[model samples]
Target: MIQVLFVVLFGAVAIWFAYKVFTTASMMRSALALLFSMTAVGAMFLALQAEFLGVLQIMMMASEMVVMALFMIMYMMNPGGLAAMEMTHQKRLSIAVAVVAGLLAVGAALFGGWPLATEAVAAPAGQTRELGLEIMERSMLVFETAGVTILVAMIATTALAIRRPA
Candidate 1:
């Protein structure tokens, strides 16, 4: 009962923060909202008894959010988020897309094929090894593709941000 309650609370918090992330006009505020949303997700994992994942999520998100905040401060005109402005484009279309996306996500959550844990839980070391194998084997291509994509994006961004002398 308590677990469910905590999970629901954190889920609500996450949703609220995520909404704020998109709704806020300030880049910095949006970044902070994203951080809060992810932290709430981590808290939900902890509530679900996924200690390793919870800690990893929180640590990774905290660092990533810091980096994002720094980037916004350096690159954005209004990183302090003091001025109110329209943050989104095509508001009606955006809301329509959001609704469709939300429905799809709910459908996936309800109907996705998830494997059941049939075997006994492994020891700590064994579990760590299993996680490594899963990441390195089953999800290797996805990870590698994401890494390459991120590398390319960073390079492109750096190039674009370089100031040319007049």
Candidate 2:
């Protein structure tokens, strides 16, 4: 009962944040809302006992997403301000196409049947901490590579965005 309630509440909050991310006029607000949504998703993963995935999601996706958004804002010279300029485009056909696509998707989902996996997806032997140790031991090179990649990407991104007169 409690778990279900938590799931429902968190799901609702995630949806709310997603809506804010899409409709909010402020770019910073949208970014913050996305962060909030991601945090909620991490919470959901934790509640489901996917502690490793939960932590990985936060570390690998949530933090990086926020950093990317911040860099984009900085590079565009927007700073902390939201872009309030209206985007002018043809919406009528797009709206119709989106509506039809949504309906088709819903209908397909309603009728589609997926076979359940016979074996339970196994959790790590000792949950998150044990998994972390295993990752450090066996996959240290992969982890270091990912970290180095992120560092290089951040430096390159910053260097490319900041122009100087020579």
Candidate 3:
């Protein structure tokens, strides 16, 4: 089916980009790879018919990556890592850990006993609107706190950037 094909393609692309993110020497390339990997995850979500989550994933990652790149450009001497340098540390240990973690994740996915709805589900006319309402009603305080925290961090960053060298 088309859904299965899309899911497989997106999953492969996501894994490849994730690998590039960790292995690429260039920091900018790594960030871009991460962005692509996250986007691929959004595509997978779309394939699974989770439109809200898919769009959220894409938008959130795009903004987060932009902020990350700005910070890297502002602070890092060589944001691109053009010079020959080892990007990763503890190579063997990292590989071992990654393999073990991956296997554990696979095992959990294959064996996890997820609860299933007993009755047939009725499709909502406006799933996104319903989700938005639910989130606003249940988690508005958490969202407001996160927004305020981000605003404070932005103000702090602006102050630091404008500070004269002393």
What C-alpha lDDT do the candidate models reach, one value each? 0.88, 0.77, 0.85
How do all the candidates rank in terms of lDDT, highest first? 1, 3, 2
The per-prediction tally of clashing pairs is: 0, 0, 0
lDDT (tens digit, per residue) of candidate 3 on 1-166: 9989999999999999998987877778888898999999999988877887898899999899978877777787677777877555898998899899999999998899878767643344366877777669988888889999999999999998796977
**For each candidate, what TM-score against the reference?**
0.71, 0.61, 0.77
Compared with the true structure, what per-residue lDDT tens digits does model 2 show for residues 1-166? 8878888888898889977886776677778888888888887887766877877776766777789678668765454555566543677887799789989998898888867677654565567666688679988899999999999999999999798998
Error of 3 at 56 (Å): 2.5
Show where candidate 1 strays beyond 4 Å: 108-126, 133-166
Kindly indicate the candidate among 2 and 3 with the higher lDDT.
3
Better of 2 and 3 by TM-score: 3
What are the clashing pairs of model 2?
A: none
lDDT of 1 by residue, 2-95 (tens): 9889999999999999999877878888899999999999999888766678889999998999899998889887776787765557989988
